[model samples]
Target: MSTTDSTATCECARAVAELREELATLRDEVAGLQRENAALRDANERKAERIETLETHVTQEFATIRERTDRIERVGYTAVGHAREHAQWMRKHDRLHDALKSRRERFDERLWDLETGEIDVQDVIDAGTNDLPIQTRTKERKTNPDALRGNKKRSTFIWPEFYARSRKTSGGNLIVTTPDAANILAEAGVKHDNETTKRAMRFVARLSGNRDDPNHEEHLIRFEPGERGKSPARLVADAGEFEQFAREASGMDVTDSENDETDTQDDSDDIVGAEADEQMDTLLNATTEGS
Candidate 1:
C-alpha cells in the first residue's frame, strides 16, 4: 500500500468515530425530554380533577344559600302582613268600647233595682237581661248578639270565662305538672303537642339570654336517659313569658288553679265588675292615637 493512502484511511476512521459519539449524545437527550413530558402530563391531569371537585362543592353551597334566603324572605313577608291586619282590627275596637260602656251603665241600674226589692232575681235571669255578663258562675259565658258586632268579633278570639276568673293581682312562674293544669290550657285552645312543647321549651331557654348553653332542654323536662316515654314532661315559664303566650295563643287569662272547683259563687259578681273594667281599658288602649 502507498503511504498517502494509509494516512487518508486513518483520517477517515477518526472522523467516523467522532460522528458516532455525537449521535449517542443526541439519543440520550431525546430520552430525557420524553420522561419530563410524561411527568408534566400526569401533573396536569391531577390538577384538572382537583378543579372539578372544587366546582361541584361550590355549586352545592350556592344552592343551599339561595334556598335559605328564600325561606327567610317568605317568613319576613308573612310577619309584616300579620302586623298590618292587627293594626286594622285595633281601629275597629273603639266602636265596641262605646257599646260596652252603655251595657255597664244598664247593669248598674239593674243591680240597684234588685237590691231595693223592686225586681226578682229569677225575673232578671228569665228576662234575658243578664246574657253573657262578665261573671264566673257558669262553666262558659253565653255569647251575646246584643253586643256590637266588633265586640262579638273580639269575643270570638278571647274567652269571657277565662278573663273573668283567671286574672291575678300579680304574676308568678308556673310549673305545670298536673293533668288539671294541662286540661285548663287545652280548654283555652293552647296546643300541647310534641312540637309545641319543644318550641315552648326553646323559648324559655332563650329567656336566660345565653346562646352557648346546649342543655337548656334539661330545665324544661325531667327526662330518663334510656326511656324517653317515662320522662316527666313539664312546662316551666317566667311570669311574663306565661302571660305573653296565654294572651297570644288563646287570648285568655292564665290561672295557676289546678281545678275548676276552686272558684266560689261569692266572688263571681266582683269578678264580673273587674273583668268589665279591664275589657274597657283594653278597648280604650286599642283605640288610642296611631295604635
Candidate 2:
C-alpha cells in the first residue's frame, strides 16, 4: 500500500470513533429527562389527592359545628320562654296572696269586735240598716206597681204599709223587718233550694219560743200558730241559716249581698252628688253676682 493511503485510513477510523461517543452521551441525557418527568407527574397526583381529602374533612367539620350551634340556640330560646312564664306566675301569686291577706285581716277585726261586745247585736242591726236601700219604697214601687196601688179589693194594700211601719222599728229584732233582711232571705232561698227555707223556718220557730234555745236543732221546727209554723223575721235574722238556704235554692252564694250593693250605690251617689253640687254652686254664684 502507498504511505498517503495508509494515513488517510487512520484519520477516518479516529473520526468514526469520536462520532459514536457523542451519540451515546445524547441517549443517556434523554433517559434522565424521562425519569424526572415521571417523578413530577407522581408528585402532582399526590398533591391533588391531599387537597381532596382536606376539602372533605373541612365540609364534615362545618356541618357538625352548624348542628351543635342550632341545638344551643333552641335550648336558649326555651329557657328564656320558661323564665318569662315563671315571672308572670309569680306576679299573679303575689297579687292573690295580698288580696287574701287583706280579707283575712278585715274578718279578724270584725270577729274581735263581736267577741269584745264592742259591736252589739244592735250595732249589727244598724250596720244592716246602713246597708239597706235608702229609697226602698221607690225601689219597691218600681218592682211591683200593684203593691204600691191602694185597692179596696186587696184588703187596703197591707204589704207596703207593713214594710213602711217595719222600717221604723228599733233594735236588732225590728232590723229583721228591713228590706236588706228580706233581700238576703230571698237570695238564700234562691241559691239553696228548699234547704234555706227550712233552716229559716226552724230558726224562726226557735226565736218565737217554740224551741227552748236558738242554737238547738229541735228549736228549728215551726209549729202552726198553736202548733208549729214558720216566722219570716226569725228566719231572716240568722245570716248563716239564710246563706245555706240560698245556696240550696240557687246553687250558688248570694253574690249581690247588701254590703256590695251598698258600696256600688254609694259610689254612684258620690259621682252624681259631686256633679250636681258643682253645677248648683256655679248657678247660685252666677245668680248672686248678677243680682
Please tell me which predicted candidate would have the highest TM-score against the true structure.
2
**TM-score of predicted structure 2:** 0.33
Residue-wise C-alpha lDDT for candidate 1, range 1-291, written one tens digit per residue:
899999999999999998888888888988898988899889889989988988998999899989998998898889889888887877677667776776676567456545654333433243242222212112222223222222211222222222222233345544433233334435645546543344333222322222212134423112111235665444343445534432332223212112333332222322343444453333222221120
lDDT of each: 0.41, 0.40
Backbone collisions counted per model: 0, 26
How large an RMSD does model 1 have?
A: 22.5
lDDT of 2 by residue, 1-291 (tens): 899999999999989888888878878888888888889889889989988999999899999999999999999999889999999999999999997887676567546545754223432343233111112222333345443221111111212122222232233322233233345434323233233333333323333222223334433222222223434332222333422332332211122323445234323333343343332232212211211
> Alpha carbon lDDT of residue 141, candidate 1?
20
Consecutive 10-residue window with the lowest summed lDDT within model 1 = 130-139
> Candidate 2: lDDT over CA atoms?
0.40
lDDT of 2 at 197: 36
lDDT measured at residue 50 in model 2 versus the true structure, 0 to 100 = 89
